[model samples]
Target: MDSMMMGAMSKNMESMPDMGMMDMSVMQACMDACAACEQACTVCSTQMMDCSPACMNCADMCNTMMRSMMRMQGMTPASMMAMLNACIAMCQVCMDECMRHADDSDVCRMCAQACQACMDACMAMKDMMMASA
Candidate 1:
């Protein structure tokens, strides 16, 4: 996200009751990672390999995760955590599947890397939330 949008999100988040004073930078990183992972998975899915199904599933999960993060209203801490966990799990599955074909396909390798990055970003977001809690 751009600085203006991020500032707007930070201001918005500060007003929320359930998610008070969140680290917007962490949220931004997570969102960016999710977007990148989603794109990578989408591209990888078109390769029609064994990992296609997993890639498609992961892309959908990442898109949902990003959208949920973008809309913070009505989202409880528990729900946010659940979403993060689900995203991480889906990324793990996609990464594992892609890694199996990493040697044969550069696209799979790139997708797996994106999945790992997304997992790490989501983990960081989860850790930040837990610590604040």
Candidate 2:
């Protein structure tokens, strides 16, 4: 993350009330992972592998998740949880498919890493939400 973005995120965290809402750190991590996953998935999709379907799906899902967080007021706790679950599932599917070709494809390996990072971020967000609740 860039220093400017880190500063903005820090400000946001400081401004937000600690009332079971999304944590900025967790959200930032998720956003970063989603962006990485999207990029990786796009590259992997261009490889024309059998994993293209999952890669495309994951790319779309990650983009949506990142955008949703950017406009997070539209989401309730229920919606947030549902979105996280969907994103995690999408990442899992993408990771599984990419792993099939990981030994032979650099794109697949990068995509799998991005997926794992995204999944971890989503899980952390869920855990934080539940703890705050």
List the global CA lDDT of all models.
Answer: 0.94, 0.86
- Score every model by TM-score: 0.97, 0.88
Question: For residues 9-70, what per-residue lDDT tens digits would candidate 1 score against the true structure?
Answer: 78888778778558888999999999999999999999999999999999999999999998
Model 1 ranges with Cα > 4 A deviation = none
RMSD from true fold, candidate 2? 2.2
Model 2: ten consecutive residues of lowest lDDT: 13-22
Model 2: per-residue Cα lDDT over 5-112, one tens digit each: 766755655444533555677778888889999999999999999999999999999999988876654667788889999999999999999999999998899899
Output the number of the TM-score-best candidate. 1
Say which candidate scores most in lDDT.
Answer: 1
